[model samples]
Target: MPSSTYLTPRLADLSVSERPQERLESQGPQSLSDSELLAMILRSGSKGRNVLSVASEILQESGSLNGLLKWSDAEFRAIKGIGKVKALQLITIVEICRRVRERSPVTAPILDSPDLVFDFMRQDTQNLEIEKFWTLCLNRKNRLIKKVEVTSGTASNSLVHPREVFREAIRQGASAVICAHNHPSGDPSPSAADIKVTRQLRESAKIVGIDLLDHLVVGNPEHDPLSRGYYSFQESGLL
Candidate 1:
């Protein structure tokens, strides 16, 4: 094996000709690899490993950038060389990325398409270990205003309430909202409780003047919710 003291040639290790920072400054962020982008966040490696090695380990263990974002702090900390501080650091970076994505211009015109709803929610909610209810507040034009986490739990109806859903919509001056939740079991099949909560939210939105556009249940694409003939409120005539 190579000497444990050898520092890996990560972005930080490159000279002005080879570094990601230099390349990004001269070229652009798109010029960098996934590991290079992640290495930039990692900054430095532990004693034996360099940032590239650390980034590789993270990618390998987590499976992908999406997988990295999906990992809990506890799961990240379980990595051989990662500790609590590093785990927090990794999660914080992911959180910032999420917020930035959330705040990005809604240049893409919103549609009533359930696929759009699924794509939007998949950016953050798909791989959560616990159930989380999210409300996507939209303007009259159907453009996104904001996305809020209403509640989190194991069961859909256990934590989500109509009051909490509409309160934020009213505060944001939203004309409509889309309710969504993720299934960690990789089945996007909406439960009976999901339907019940959605019905309640739809009624509340009616009373509050905020239209309920749709309620989407998301699971991993690998699992084939649609092909598996999972529940879609629109398809089921529940919407």
Candidate 2:
């Protein structure tokens, strides 16, 4: 058989100017090819390959960087020269990219309908690995003033208190509030606890002098509840 890529020259043996690191530093990252960026991530390769060669092999097999999202740790490790550390690095890169996509400057909306509420928070909440509760504090005109996290809990459920939900709203001088929480199970069906919490918030809002516009549950559209993957208590007349 022809010699394995393991016998190829090490990445460090390449001309200094031609190296991925060197080019990235001198020419800016935008100047580099996708494989070159991944090469910097892979760092080096097995006996017959170099860093670029290994990164290229992975790209070819995976189709593109987006493919990395679908790959499990075991699948990453199965690639030649990829060990646990490298596999984790790739996975982390994918996660960082995903989170970056989620983050953006918050823009206020009219908050007049369930669809507006759902789309406003969906970008921040989709594909979460655990439950997270957030309160959207809005002004009297229904313009969003702030979107803040109240609590992050386990995969299936998050325990939240009315105090925790309204404390920030009160502090921000919000006239009304919208509560939202994700279901890691992707089922938007509200639990007894969910109903109880909504009623509790409703009662607390009456005392605090602020309206509870809605309590929205975010989940998978496939799980049921009209296949919308979201529920608004205000829309359903639950609140």
Candidate 3:
């Protein structure tokens, strides 16, 4: 068996020019490779392996840095040298990244573009361990007013309440709302339950004088709704 020492050298051991943090400080984050960026989070490795090696292993196992967010704590700990502390650290860091991405400014209005809608939703909804139903309140011009979480549940159901959905929209004085949810399975294809929820929300919005702009099912990049040809109620003339 290959000893863990076979792993890559430590970030600190590298020359100043080659270190991820040094490179990031001097050249910016975009200049670092995915493993290098992750190395900054892992910080240190097991007794035998260096941080870069552990990060590389994690990225290789996960297929990408973002993909690591999909892993549960237990799953992450099951890796060769990671333990509970490392697992929690990884989870916390990923969560912070998700939150930061979600809160980032939306300079442009979230128009009818499904891609833009997906971009906004993916910041929080993507890589979720369970299903989450959320709404984006929009003004008449389709500019984003606020994003609110309506419900959360297991893989099959988000158990969203129509009243809760509209309450925020009304409070925000939104003229319209776009409902979005995610599948942990990475498939954005709308399920029958998803369709039922959309139809319900649309009818409720109508009764409450709020327009249901669209219902978007968000998933991973590989299973992107727009790319995979998923149906939207507005586009199908069902609304």
- TM-score for every candidate vs. truth? 0.53, 0.56, 0.53
Greater-TM-score candidate between 1 and 2: 2
lDDT by residue for model 2 over 194-224, one digit each (tens)? Answer: 9999999999999999999999998777875
lDDT of 1: 0.76
lDDT for each residue of candidate 3 in 130-222, tens digit (9 for 90 to 100)? 998888899988999888898888866688878989999999999999888888877777788877877898889879999998888777756
lDDT of 1 by residue, 1-239 (tens): 25544656434445786676677788889998888788777776776677777877888888889887678889878765678888898889888877787778757558477877776677686457888878888998998888889888874333688998888889999999888878877687777788788788878877888888888787776676455312457656776
Against the hidden true structure, what lDDT does model 3 obtain? 0.80
User: Residue 221 of model 1: what lDDT?
Assistant: 65
- Check candidate 2 and list the clashing pairs: 5-48, 5-49, 6-47, 6-48, 7-47, 7-48, 186-220
CA displacement after TM-score superposition, residue 8 of candidate 1 (Å)? 35
- Order the numbered candidates by TM-score, best leading: 2, 1, 3
Q: Which stretches of candidate 3 lie over 4 Å from their true place?
A: 1-108, 224-226, 229-231
TM-score of 2: 0.56
Query: What is candidate 1's CA lDDT for residue 21?
Result: 68
Q: Is candidate 2 or candidate 3 better by lDDT?
A: 2
Name the weakest run of 10 consecutive residues (lDDT summed) in model 1: 224-233
Q: Cα deviation of 25 in candidate 3 (Å)?
A: 37
